[model samples]
Target: MTGRPPKRQRIEPRFHDGESGSLDMRLTAEDRPAAGQRPNAPRKAKPANRQNASSGSRSGPARRKSAKSRRGKGGRKRRGGNSRLLRFVKRGAYWSAVLGIWGIVVVAGVLGYYAAHLPPTSEWAVPKRPPNIRIVSASGHLIANRGDTGGEAVRLEQLPHYLPEAVMAIEDRRFRSHFGIDPIGLARAVFVNASSGRLVQGGSTLTQQLAKNLFLEPDRTFSRKMQEVVLSLWLEQKFSKDEILEMYLNRVYLGAGAYGVDAAARRYFGKSARLVTLNEAAILAGLLKAPSRYAPTNNPKLSEERAQTVLLAMHDAGYIDDDQVKVALAETATIVANRQTSSENYVADWVMELLPGYVGSIDTDVIVDTTIDLDLQHAAERSLRTALASEGGKLAVSQGAVVTLDGSGAVKALIGGANYARSQYNRAIHARRQPGSAFKPFVYLAAVEQGLTPETIRVDEPVRIGNWAPQNYTRKYRGPVTLTEALSLSLNTVAARLAQEVGPARVIDTAQRLGISSPLQKNASIALGTSEVTPLEIAAAFVPFSNGGYGVVPHVIRSIRTMKGKLLYSRKGDGPGRVIDPYSLGAMNRMMAETLSTGTGRAAELEGRPAAGKTGTSQDFRDGWFIGYTGQLTTAVWIGNDDNSPTKRATGGSLPARIWKDVMVAGHDGLPVSALPGIYEAPVQVAEPAGSGLVPPGRIGDDPGRPILPEPGKGRGPLNLLQRIFGG
Candidate 1:
């Protein structure tokens, strides 16, 4: 049957272990029988290597962790092993790993770091930017002292060579050579803080100190420390040694509201940063730790003591010779209080209020070229100080506000109040009070625009409106008068009657067009200055007349620059809306000019300069304003109580006008004349009285010229005022 192959091997499945099987093809070397004898027989399994086998699983024993390889094997590093900044922050995780592996890393990586460090950093080539600075007259009530904002910053290398030596001796000795990140200093700080349980001291490096002063918070947290360290290194790589040092020197706080060494020098010695003496530098340096506590103004004894300490430190550190230290310690100002402030800061606070929205921040080293000339500001401050001093510098309720704008509407000077620091209310720009007769020019201009000439006549008789009878400041009225005389004399009755004749709506419109941003009443009583307005608005509204009717839009920021010296903003020189006819404006200008020459604002007339302006005295003597312009400058002055209480005999021509005059004298001392543009003298023509064969009463309809009628009740106040003026 086998021979025929047909009788078929009975198909049988067998287990390989104990029975002949079809699946097992292998036979052990010695266990295999000859082919003929092993045919149809199962092969024996080979012996296993028991030494390397696991208990049951097919995988080998865990031999991946070879003793030699496992020593430093995983490649993960310790906390601060190889990071760029530090391990305290998660961002430094990668850098920390790199530093830890440095010992065994490829030569390539080590070479890379060294190569990155090797290139000489490019010089800090940031261009300087002209700072957008604002000038303001200090207010009588708010300013602690009246002084103008000016002067240039000081450079570090130019600091009396002894200056750096003194600073190093007093602050930190090893500031020059160390890299920005000082590990030893951090360790010392850590040790001290750990022992005290409270952070009592920090041995921060100069770079760290700079970091704190420039960008970081004042806290001493681990994360902050890491950021400071990394940022300081970055700064070191970015700025030149001298440039960084200079920035730090000029920006650091020196207390007493004196920000930098330059400000301190001026505050202490009435000198520029470049002209400070060795003792002055020592005194300024001593102000670093706690400027207010040791300022010479509040405590000269303490300030002198601190200065002596700094001098001794400098001498011991070899910053100054023994002889120089002795001289520095012995130096003293003849009169410290006299050195407190050269001028009052009445207008300076005004500028501060108007400046921020235009420039944003005052922390940078921006060079602001203000419209104010410091010499002029000083002159104005001097005059006010002398006048007020006679009354103990607290004339009446004791506060004043002043404003000066160039023909271009650039504020040349400002004084918001008498004591800027003690009383912080900025009366010049922020206070809104009745302008009284001062609001007449705008109403008269409206009349001129509405088909009436300056020669037009109106009865200056007393009139009642809804139980409200506004009397003249003198409680008397001129019978029939030209519009010019009414404004020049600031007659309340005539102004009210004129407001009625011109349509109060038009008066409000005229005020708005001239730069009055406050909400105006619709009632005609506005003609008598019944509505409230700010001194800033009064000053700005009059600017068009100064510019010869070629209106100038009031703007503070001429231009803005970034910290890195990029231009961010620049004024477009847009002019104010041309409201009045050229002839009408010129006629009004002549009368206002006369107001200074012979009328109420006679105080405003300078000895050598041709001046023109008006005086406004509100009810209860609560607000007083004198606004005018000269050949070179135009200024506005306001005197009032900060609490809005009535002043004792305060009037536009009294203290306020004098401040304007003083500011002008100082502000325009040497400036060339800038002739008013668009001026044209009106032809003299006799105005026909009303009710002739000419126009009769009410003949002129109450027509608001070309108004884009606002929805009912929108600015209803201005609209209502217009109705009252129309005798509604």
Candidate 2:
């Protein structure tokens, strides 16, 4: 026991039966009379029986002899009474010895239990583990539990009176009015054991049960019983009756994968503990003994029978009236297991996988306030489903992910995969597919940095950068095209020449500054998205252009709060150093705006908002991509089969663009209209390329915050420091 008392005596013995002999046949000092009185000064005559008649006849025949014998008989009779008393005393001594040993064992066991488990007053026996429950949202009304991230917690004083009464009736009738131990009930249990010829029966009170559940060993044993009594007494002394009752209700197991009454309440009735009816409470109470076998979720018939037993107990305990019993008997428990069916199924696995990454570990009751806008998440899902339906062919897809962020780099909505269950291959955060033509903007940014404007001339005709012949998507070159037209039309040949002109090294440097972590090859085809990249990398890379050419990293967790509601840590938005000149960033935005306005993304034109976006259709259409953003929000969409096979007739504009538009429309429903945070001016006046039809350039914005140029040897700093430590 954690803190229970030793042992208790049920019945106090009154007297000892230790006498020597029969009263009539023994002599005693009392029969000799007092010192001043005569030794046999005539004993008081007693009412005589049949034996007395014979005495009278014998006295007459031998009057003298009889008188003498009678004189001696009084003393003998007195001694006889003393002897009988002595014998009774001896027998009483034997009984006392047996009772003493029994009492000592009981008391010793109780004391040992009390000493061992006396300190802990709470539910110390439960496994010390991180809670697995993840509530999607916050409940406004209740104080949350320790495991409750956003859910409710019920307190002791708030318990409905009927809840405890039902529990008391179902678990242990004599809960109160005991000093943490119930001797009478134990005796009765002993009788029951004797009748059944087994010791499975017990008389552990509710307090004892609570004590056992909270702190002591679970093994059914006399020693455990002693410990339970000790712990129960200690708990009773420490906590109030109501508090103990509440703990019992909230901590008791109720089967169906539910722990406390609150979880059970939600699982069965699709509601909170406060709303459960008396009948519902009774049904739950019935599950106290053998929760699995009697659970309403598993066996309704047996559960009803058990509930009736609880009701009858309650009626006997005078807790309910006749009508209530009748009604309870007639009612059936309608328990729907896991009321939130399929809700947790879709997000649980993804959320769990991310839990550790967000907090650097997942073994705490850390509250993760995600930027997931449930509304946009729903819309993204709906639009994708609609597009899939239009295809009329089931896509051989294992997973899908979407990441939508506001213009300020705040992730608005995200779904890691369609079902985070079948496989937790979070494509939104993990998969690295080639960006195809989607990477052209970085090439444009590189060109602008090297004194090249959007209208800078480049040939879209067949071009050979070394051995690779970069051609247009149609394989037929468009001859000469301005940079603006090339970007909009996604002409591959023009982009390849621009990268070659900027020198492959500078282009690679620019991609790195834009927060693309994957290695980029120093080849001409790099402009055509030959390198692999994740969607998150693309979103994060675009954040710089969105935020006036300042690099910003993407992060999900804002702050971590402990299970006890203490703040542990937070993620501040400090990323890798600034990249891209504001002037170049603005020029790229202008070109992308044109791309959306009248080019490949002409399908993306909204009602009145000015938007900029790009479309990417890789070779064989293995991956379809659309990276788009308004002045307010930025969203990127990619759709393809996971097997890297062609999505039949699917283009970035076909389905991905539509999904992107739908997601952005829902995600940007609120907020103000602000200009994109970039330079107001354009590049310094430059000669327009032939057939470009470009607008005249304004003065260039301040040439500050250029992409951090890679050091001569990829920084011999931290990487070198670790290398030195290991001498590797």
Candidate 3:
């Protein structure tokens, strides 16, 4: 083509109407632009005819359609993008609604599950509080309270204003404002507990606490919490604010077996709720958090600290001014020493044991009038504690018990242990231990009933029975001694010999008849006090020796009645009947009397009055006992180790005799000196003034009707001696 090629000519096409009435145009090569060159503009041409113009309009429609297609394509892209976003938003909304419904269902299901375990709303009601047992001494002084509700319910108005105020201030500040639930407090507690990873605070209101104590078991669980919330709401709706507070104060448990604020006040302060002071009220309020932990009797210093916290709370709540808080802080509550650790609780415990038998199923508040003389109880406890404090460590003795009874078998004083707080085991009424030679009285009484006189001779020598040989305490033999002398010296062999002479069965019968209810083994060892017996029974058994041989059943509760004065049980005046004959009673008294006068029990001898008793030392000095009595009272003292370990040679004549003498001295204070029953002999000398009505010492007899000794061969001794001395 480059070798001298001919040049190409340009051609322009013109529009024309074809036979089909369509417009058309044509262009020659001349209209096309050369490579890399701009094309020349086409010149406008006029329509050839009207038909041609109309045909030209068809081309305009084709161009417009092409432009419309381009615009539609862009709009389609925009529409597609918008539709995708709309679809995404719609899908999200649908799923959100589904999840919301499921969440509501789950919460409702959880709530329903917990609600199903609760009782029906119609059946829900506040449970009745358990009845209380109030025990008072013979003088009508409250000794203790025994029951689920330790004391009777106290009205809100009956208590001091500060008492309830302090409780609300520390326990629930918004108790009167909230509807049983403090959402603010609960949220704060939750946040704190979660942040600290431990539970250090509680969000329960006073009504909630009452609900838990009244109806719910002490369990920690989500279910229990839910139930508590439900019950709290119910309680709030049913009871007034004052009523709820009163019920909470009365139903909440305090320490030391106290149930209500009244009981706690009486238990720790020895006063009623109405008499509690501001300091005392603060202390009581403090115990609501942890009763045992902050009990004044348990930890006084810690309790005071807790009370200080309560006082501050009270001040902040505007219940008390700064001066009042200062006064409260300065004047700490004085906890009554006796109420917390008194020996009266021992008597109260005994009364409680006998309560159910007197009135079965205690369903109401009852008052028990017990025979415990507060004075004598104080004396007994004082003497026992004094003795133990002085000689407990020296003698290696750790515990002791005492029991005292009047001629009519009324328990005047009873000390179960050295410290009742340390041990509640009532040794006086429950513990059974060998009485050693104390049992010899039963053996001698049996002998006397079989015609053996106090002057009767019995050789004190080593004796054996069925491979068992009994030796005297002194391990020496007295060739011949009277029955009185043998018993006064507490000769073990002689007692064994007598048991053999008069069958052991007879001795047991005599013991049982005299109020020794414990079982006795039918063997020779029984005569030497090998059998175990409680101090109560032993003291009761000796009552006849001082009261004309009339048997007695040891009783502490004299009468029981409801709080409204409805009598439930009243002790009758009838005696336990005669258990020993005149001759036997006289003979036994004569022998036992010599023990206090010049024998092992000499330490227990009274100064201005005649006393009779026996001394007993168990094997290896494991137990030391002195059971003695005067014309006024009979008391038993036992000192030993709780572990049954031997002492440092402590004998009945030492600690036991001294404690018995001290107790007797206090018991017989201000009373006229009198002779023992069946003993018409006067005292050696009149220790008091002549106008004191004291029988002069060395007098032959006071009563002119004293019986005279009968002939040696008489059928039985004269009954006049006993009849005159005992007023039989």
Candidate 4:
């Protein structure tokens, strides 16, 4: 085929110009010349002329110059314009990389510096929590968790899944996947904050929050943040994700005097965390941002609103469904009432006071088994609060206290004040005030011991001794009344005359035998409760009359045990053995019982049970006290001002007796109604002799400022030293 084509060799030509010559073009590899031969090639010879040569040699440079000129007019302008933009982009990239590197370096430097300041990793340890005093009532119900933490550490699995889930959803959603820190979250936070021009969210994870709460100081500085990061990494390395979450849940502060979720749950809802509902979990989880502000006890509306936000977040995190969110949103969290919440706190504090004696120094956690009856405690608190609320302003009673004790001297219930949160000073045990007429029992007991029967007649008329002349509270004295009537009427003059007859020493001895732990004055006025005494002392002193004249020592904590179930202390025996004389006890009980049945403390009479008590109004009504008892319990109530200001004639029969009656009624609910332990004497209403007109003795002294005895006693008054030795 090639030889045949070669024979024809037909040519195709093309013309460039109108006048022109033809030019041959190679169309394929077959038209190219052979390698060794010059065949099939055409060349033009050079012309020999200086001007033409110069023009020909200059053509390339001239064309290039012409193209450069054209480029300067258009292409160069385009290229230069693009060059600035490229240079800008390149410079931006360079500086961005440089700044990024510097930023990393600075952050690394900060982290290193803060980490250097931290304690050695080998020495790092979770410090032991402060000693927690777990106080429980007589029925073994948790009265109050007292200490810095206010609760015990709970395990991770012990809490409900919704609890930690709520925490993670609202606090740190990526808690599972993130390695201590989440850069994506941080970047998003920065972006959102920058775009909104406000910090809407924090970049810290739950681990970081836990780290700050557990290990680091709460300071919002770069150093603090860096330390938090380092601690968070340490925590991640030391513990699992669940362990971290558990620590956080157990240690995080939840306000309302609650240090952990357990305490908070109990404080707000009166339930354990395991029993907390989803709504409660959300509310508790919402407290992490601001515990006080979101506390349900503080503001339920705000707490519920924050909880709604938390529920929405949980739904968005896919932890809860729409129905659940809706249900949670609709649910309302009811905080525990303040009175009920802190009722046990007073008992807990009372128990704590006795904890040191039982367990010595509280180096380890101890459980104090207190004698507080929570129900009775609540009753006492409610009674006191209700009494104060209804009559406090009218009576000028700014504060009040109630103490209820069983016959065995066990403090069944105690309320220190109207509100424990407002005042912690336990007036029931610590407040010492004069017990006006309430102290007359000792005087009557002394008189009965000295052979003065309840029918012993005493003239109530005034008698002056040296400088003092005591007047009746009513300013009108009943003439020639029996000892029983004089005491029932709380006649000051009769009480003074009896004190003088028995001698103040015997009266002091009688009070000490019964359980007055306070100092009693040896002066004649001692018969009128001129000495300061605590409500607890008064209540305890009345116990002997209820318990057939057996003395009692008031004790709250019954036993104490360590967290490991080792018994630290236990009360072995009963109170000081039989301090009161049986005869005197019977006579005193009979006389004092008459006071409640038909006297100043008549308002304290129970509907079904016979009661015995005394009404005491301190000088100028500074304090109103009702120390009363039934067969089962003896309670004392004090109503007064913390500032020692006089009340609006508040007598023991008004507020104090009412409170005592309420408490005793509630305390004796199930117990059988029994008569008070004593001898009962029938009322002896004597007919006044028509011709016997009782006249008061003449005033002897220029100044009648001192109180006097109506008749002389057989022996001298008991020494104050001996009274002190035998009494309290």
Per lDDT, the best of the predicted structures is 3
lDDT of candidate 1 at residue 87, scale 0 to 100: 46
The order by descending TM-score is 4, 3, 2, 1
Q: Alpha-carbon error at 486 in model 1, in Å?
A: 3.3
- lDDT per residue (tens digit) for residues 1-728 in model 1: 44754565675644344332233333223353644675657666544642333454221112223322443443335423656345446656766787767744654454445435432435323333222232222221211222222333566765677666666667766667667765676687789999999986667766667776666678867556656665577678887766666766766677655556766666667665677777777778888767888788768888888888888888887777878877776778532354333333544444455556765656544423244545555565566556566652344646666666766777655555665446656666778888877788888777655545444567888887677788876778888876667777777777776677768887887788777888889887798676888776678788877765545655543554543566655667566545544545665676676677767788777876666788888788888788888655667777776677887767787777777777777777667755443333323223333433222222222222222111122232444424322225
User: Residue by residue across 1-728, what tens digits does model 4's lDDT show?
Assistant: 44544466554556323322233222322343545658757533334432354545433334347546644577657778999999999999999999999999998888889999998899988766567787888888888787887776677888888899999998899999998998999999999999999989899998898888878788788888989999888899998998888878878888867887887888788777788999999999999889999888777889888999999999999999989888888877777775344766777777777776666787767788888888888888889999899999988889998998988899998888888777888888899999998898888876765545565678989877558798888899778987778888799999988888768887887788778878887899887788999989889988888886678889897889888899988887888766554444555666777788888888888887878889998889999989988778899999999999999999988899889898988898888978876454222222222432211112111112211111123212333212221222
For each candidate, what TM-score against the reference?
0.62, 0.67, 0.74, 0.77
What TM value does model 4 have?
A: 0.77
Model 3 misses residue 33 by how many Å? 75
Off by over 4 Å in 2: 1-154, 158-166, 177-258, 263-368, 384-393, 470-473, 562-566, 570-578, 594-605, 618-620, 641-646, 672-728
**Cα lDDT, all candidates:** 0.62, 0.67, 0.82, 0.79
Full-model lDDT, candidate 2: 0.67
Candidate 4: where is the Cα deviation over 4 Å?
Answer: 1-110, 297-302, 339-342, 361-366, 562-564, 680-728
> How far in Å is the alpha carbon of 311 misplaced in model 1?
3.4
lDDT of 3: 0.82
Task: Give me the runs in candidate 3 sitting further than 4 Å from their true place.
Answer: 1-116, 182-203, 217-222, 254-257, 290-309, 312-318, 321-323, 337-341, 393-396, 461-469, 573-575, 681-728
Worst 10 residues of 2 by lDDT: 137-146
Q: CA shift at 367, candidate 3, in angstroms?
A: 2.4
- Candidate 3 residues 377-487, lDDT tens each? 999999999999999999999889999999999999999999988888888889898898888998997776554567666797777798999888778999898788899
> Model 1 segments beyond 4 Å from truth?
1-156, 174-253, 257-275, 288-293, 326-330, 333-364, 385-395, 561-566, 603-610, 665-728
